[model samples]
Target: MADPAALSPLAELARRNDPDRFLCALFAPPAQREVLFLLIAFNHELARARQAASNSMTALIRLQWWRDAVEEAATSAAPRRHEVATPLAAALREGRLDAATLQGMIDAREVEMEEDIPSLPALLAYLRGSAGGFAVAAGRTLGAGPEHLAGLQALGAAFGMAALLRGIPAQAMQGRSLLPADLLAERNLTPSDAARDPRQPGTAEVVRQLAGEGQRLLAEGRARAKGLPRAALAAALPARLAARDLARLASTANDPAQPPPPRGLGDRVAVIWGGLVGRG
Candidate 1:
């Protein structure tokens, strides 16, 4: 068994930096929860690579390092020295993970590091690669079989799209845009306009459209929930929050420039309830 003490840093990282996933992990089997936290913490590190680096090249270099680390951990008996890498190696060694899917998640971050906005198809592909890939890996970790992979991927894409919509304000503030360029063009809008003022004409429509798409995807995933492996349910728990937030975003009449408020106590309760019912 791995040292519990050595895994503490990863647990703390997930709790502090990715509370949504941290909460979702609480619903997982106790023995598997730590590994889930380790996985999510690794994701957080990858997702923040751009902001943490000095430039795009630096970000690429950082991502490459993680890519190499994951590959090494997948094939080697010895563990890496870093905090995230160590537990991650242990998880991989257990033989429950798909290293290719995890590698795809890392590669997806490359799109985020670029200034150019992708088309809608390209954007969805990126989400499917990063978020969808994460979902598949998490489901696998939860003992889901090969048959459950498609459902997990759909669930992950739904959650990812909702997350992207939720992040618009913050991404805009950083002068980054995740909204598809074609959609923006259709609205006679530009990425700069969104960055400068998200409340401008047609922006709400763009948000509404994306949120609606997310909700649709969420519903589609939920339709297949009953067929998912029982253990996989906990890994999908965050979908409840994603559904709630997407609905809220779709209906908000206030400035879209503002970040959505944090999930409140009632929202948390709903998430737990949804998880318990296997509806998420």
Candidate 2:
């Protein structure tokens, strides 16, 4: 087993940077929660690589480092001695994780280093590659079988879309836009228009359309939940918050250009209740 002290930095990383996942981890099995935290922390590192990099090439280099780290963890008798890699290697040694899927998640962030705007199909594909892959890995760690992988991926995609929608303002600030090009074209808007200011006229419509698609996927994924193992439900907990957040974004009062309001007390209760009832 990995030392508890060695896992603290990963835990703190999750708590400070991804509170929704942090809260969800609280309900995971005690033995497995640390592994989940490690996985989520690794994801945060990959997702933020571009933002942290000095340039696009620098971001690609950072991603390559992680890719190599995961490859080593999978094949080496003794993995690299790094915070993220150490726990990840432990998970791999125990056969609780897959290196290929984790590598796929890392590879998917390649889009983040580019300035191109993806179409709706491309955007969904990217979500499946990153978030969907993460869900499947989390499910495996919880002892879910192959039968549950599809459902977990669907849940993850829904969660991913909602997350991308929530990130519009931040992405816009960086001059990046994840909104589908076709969707923007339909609104007679360009990627530059949305990237310059998400609050641009007709931008809300595009956001609403995307949020609707996210809600649809959320419903589809929830329908598949009945077939998933109860333990696997822990990996889907973020869907609870995603659902609430999409609803808020679709509302008239909410501004797409601003960060979504922080999760409230009621939101936390709902997330816990959903986790207990195996709803998300």
Candidate 3:
């Protein structure tokens, strides 16, 4: 990791916008750390596209630009000249990254465009493609072999699910909902209903169900992450943070609107300990 006093612009961006992954990247070699930030920056850009653009049409246009950029990076020596795009292209040219994996990250955002998730399975697929895809990319950059990819992906998904749970209240307040429609339906609720009042019994139950799934994924990820190489394990460190958040959420009666306070010191310690021990 770069010195805290002399972070590169990309490193600073990751540190501010993605603290969990940023902490994990600190465990990687210096060269790999820079490349990991490139992926982090790219993912951040893709993540904000929907909010940045004026409409869904504009968002699709922006996402398509990324798709085209990824294609160019994969196929040619020179890709687009944007900050994140240029570095991403370099990673692609160096064989540390691939177009399909990056494309899958973009494809997963299509679900975000929908007003409501259709089912728990659909939400899982979206998280796997977006967050899981990102971890796989980072693991590859950190020199992980094929055998470690699945575990890395699962760890990433666990983090993603936990994150979504934390953000539910904010999303609902904005007239958006990430709760799956079918899950809500089982309790005689709709996404809009949940959005209007996430603390209702039905919505709370859905949150618990989601939390349970996150715990299962976290356990599975940790199990599979056993014996992973040290560098590769860095990419799975977010699972540690996820486990912490899930435990807190469960204790709060799975209330989507009542997130636990941010655990800055605990987060840093958890990532550091997990890194040193090569455990997610």
Candidate 4:
């Protein structure tokens, strides 16, 4: 278990907003764990930008602010003074994180603000940049070798797909749907209609197709992770949680309208078990 006193404010933020990563971080050595916390917390902040903003332009402005902050952090001795930025700047300076990859993450979120995803390939690209890219950064922070980074990203994408599917209900309430626009169109549904009610005909099929893709990615990621260093396991461990969610998705008949059950003791136990096994 992670000691509360040992967690920095940023790490606590990760614990509150991104508990799966937080639980996985506990398996790392203290210093690496702190970097993991910073990375995940930074991601949580990026994810919130769209919802926090009153309009699309405002959301772009918020993302641009983070981009400038990241640029400054990578080049300047005196980086921005924000809580997350301070340590993130230190990580950028220390080479524990990469500037271009971080930039790519920002780009992904910017794309996410769009209502139409166009195609399945385009949607996967967003997942690759956002979740998969973030995992690659975290894996590096935990001393994962360059060779394992691609697999780490794949693992993260799998987790991202699961997360996206599970959040459909909440996102719908907010007038957003991440489903591929083309897929929805084939069913004669618009993004707004799917957002309003995922249980409507053809919506469940979209969810099913996405869930199947998530499972495929999980398998490929697991195969690739077999070669990762033992120390890198925690960084990739969220795939286990993804697997569980993907499985539940099938049991629920792949209903996008069905909200995910809250994470409980079983979820934590699964992370612990995945950590022990050194596979996600």
The lDDT values for all models are 0.80, 0.81, 0.84, 0.86
Indicate the worst ten consecutive residues by lDDT in candidate 2: 1-10
- Summarize candidate 1's per-residue lDDT along 144-206 as a digit string, tens digits: 777777767777888888888888799887887788877888999877777778887678788
List TM-score per model, in order.
0.93, 0.92, 0.95, 0.96
Q: Which stretches of candidate 1 lie over 4 Å from their true place?
A: 1-7, 252-254
Candidate topping lDDT: 4
RMSD of 1: 3.0
Candidate 3: tens digits of C-alpha lDDT, residues 68-175 = 898887575577888788878888887878778899999999888877899999999999999999988888888777887888888899889988889887887678
Q: What is the lDDT of residue 147 in candidate 4?
A: 79
lDDT of 2 by residue, 180-265 (tens): 87889988888888889888757888888878888887877777655677776788888888888889877777678998777799
Per-candidate clash tally: 0, 0, 0, 0
Give Cα distance to truth, residue 45, candidate 1, Å.
1.0
TM-score of 1: 0.93
Q: In candidate 3, which residue ranges exceed 4 Å CA deviation?
A: 1-4, 252-254
Displacement of residue 138 (Cα, Å) in model 3 is: 1.0
How good is model 4 by TM-score?
Answer: 0.96
Residue 76, candidate 4: Cα error in Å is 3.0
Clashes of 4: 0
Q: Worst 10-residue stretch by lDDT in candidate 1? A: 1-10
Clashing pairs in 2: none
